[model samples]
Target: MSVTRTNPALTLGKYVALLAYLLFALFPLYWLVKIAITPDRLIFTEGTDLWPSTTTLDNFRTVIFQTDFMAFFGNSLYVSLGTAAVTTILAAGAGYAFSRFDFGGKKIIVAVMLITQMFPLLMIIAPIYKIVASLGMLNSLTSLIVVYTAFNIPFATFLMQSFFDAIPKDLEEAAMMDGCTRFQALRKVILPLTLPGLGATLGFVFTAAWSELLFALMLISDNESMTFPVGLLTFVSRFSVDWGQMMAAGSLALIPSCLFFIFIQRYLVQGLTSGAVKG
Candidate 1:
């Protein structure tokens, strides 16, 4: 029997739909870049223009030289990286146990984790604040890191559990048969296979922490301790808004996240579990 190929029209339509969705998603980013490069005088005049009539890098220069953007960027980086690292490690460990073990209270533990995700963050904010205050971590970057890590862990743990489930137990068992201990098998065989999951978890947690504003606003009082999301609020004074500077800072803040995804996107594409199981 001859295998039939997909119809050309259907394939073309699928590509068309994907292209349309991509353009729809990316149009805002295009507009942002357009606004960032446009001269202040032309900003109002060139409203909705695909290309700016005049462009200048002065907005970026002013944001960098005349603002506390670097400090905010550094704070965001520290918090995001710290949250990502801590969350990923905890999630990975929890996920491995969830996937590999059969123990009493496992179902109850998972149900409780799910329940934790059900509550609105507003309900817990007061208690979280009180706890942080009691620990003298209020208004500190460490507070932000702790809060972000805690908030992100449940979801990251679920993500990691899915990844761990996708991996085969036989691989670990085989390693054990070859004289490797459990830890050695996990470190040498399973850990390499879980890199994609780890990368995705790190990226997810980092972006979540980087964009979080509510906890940062509530916990951090010092200007020097502000993350980029809260720092962006500085442009919104009581009377006037600094649109140019805000957009410039927003654009700058996108760089690290972009670079991070670019570095991890390769591993994310690889299906490390392809050979781990028998079909």
Candidate 2:
């Protein structure tokens, strides 16, 4: 057997480059947390300081208690989770069908889906708003969920289709030959392998719904129904902005996304490796 060797100098350089990239990427997050804890008065004064002379939990406290923060947070969470689940389920079924079946209008349907994605959201916002208004869905969380699910399904279907493509049809066929139904074979053999794809689709849909402001702003006029992104605007006034409280709220908003990624990170890694390796 031959031993594999790596250049120490090259390895060190790569590590240094990776470290630099990480720092560059994470600096904004670090600054967000820093500003969240920094006292309001000291924010501008100590903005450039690596460490604040003083820090306080007052911003977090006020945000959590005195404002509509929790309500907005809850609204955002509900919409995002609802959208993710609905979109993923529909996308998975559609993807599997697309992958396994040859049906009439298959190419045309895919082309339409692609076309839908090509238009800027601005162009369709008015039409979407009109449709929602006609349906009496304006200012409704359920409406937001429905709209998000619709918008996400096409791309998510394509994503899941790619994952299904990576998996061999022979696996399901063999299971069917073993006296299992097609659904059974899918559940027992194929679904488990598609976990990475499902996780990725969920992450994508969740992030999309969570950060969506335009549709929410257009459809939701009520203060109570406003999602977190729109609610963040409350911290801004005509004359001045509440930097500390805004930053605090922004920092808090990142928790769900981070926890979600942490939960699915393993699946994401598996997806990367699954693409890299071949039989």
Candidate 3:
């Protein structure tokens, strides 16, 4: 066998490129936090400065205590978690069915879902608004949750189906051969393997619902029911904006998404090997 040498220069170049890319991507988030901590008086004066001459926690303090921020936060939390949980469960079931079952109209059903995604939300928002209004569900968190779940399910189902497709059907077959019912085999043998898929779907749906502004803005008129994205607009007024407080709130808004990813990150890892199975 011939030995080969590694290219140190190429390796260094790759690392340098990756570092540059990461800095470029994360710079905006850094700026958000930077503005958040900077005192209000210096916001316009030192806007371009990488670091503020002076910083304060007053922005954070005000966002947390001086406004209806907590109510908005709680409303968003409830809607997002409710949407994510409902969407994930429904998607999981539908995905498994699509993956394993050969049913009539499977192709047609999939095509319909794909078609639904093709139309922009703006195109159908009016009809949706009319329906929700007729039901007297306007300005309600539950309505937001329901609408979010409905809109998210098709894409979420497709995402989950791709994950299910990645898993081998033989695992379930083997479990069934040992006398487990289909549902039992699915629960005991298949679900554990699909943890990565489940985690990813949950994360995706949660992020989507959490950041959604248009629907929340349209459906929720009541301040008590507003989600965080809508609530953030309270910082803006007829003539001015509260930059420090707005940035502080934006920075704080990132916490739940970060914590959620942290919680599911382990399940997001793929390629855990088992000696019992050979591919």
Each candidate's number of clashing pairs is 0, 0, 0
Tens-place lDDT per residue, model 3, 1-279, is: 744876899779989999999999999999999999999999889989999999899999998999888889999999999999999999999989999999999989988877777789788788889999999999988989899998888888877777788899999999999999999998999999988788878887898899999988888888888899998875455214788888898898999998877876664533112101111
Worst 10 residues of 2 by lDDT: 270-279
Clashing pairs in 1: none
lDDT by residue (24-119, candidate 2, tens digit) is: 999999999998899989988897899899999999999999999899999999999999999999999999998999999999998888777778
User: Is 1 or 3 the stronger prediction by TM-score?
Assistant: 3
The TM-score values for the models, in the order shown, are 0.85, 0.86, 0.86
Who wins the lDDT comparison?
2
lDDT (C-alpha, whole model) for all candidates: 0.82, 0.87, 0.85
lDDT-best of 1 and 3: 3
User: Model 3: which ten-residue window has the lowest total lDDT?
Assistant: 270-279
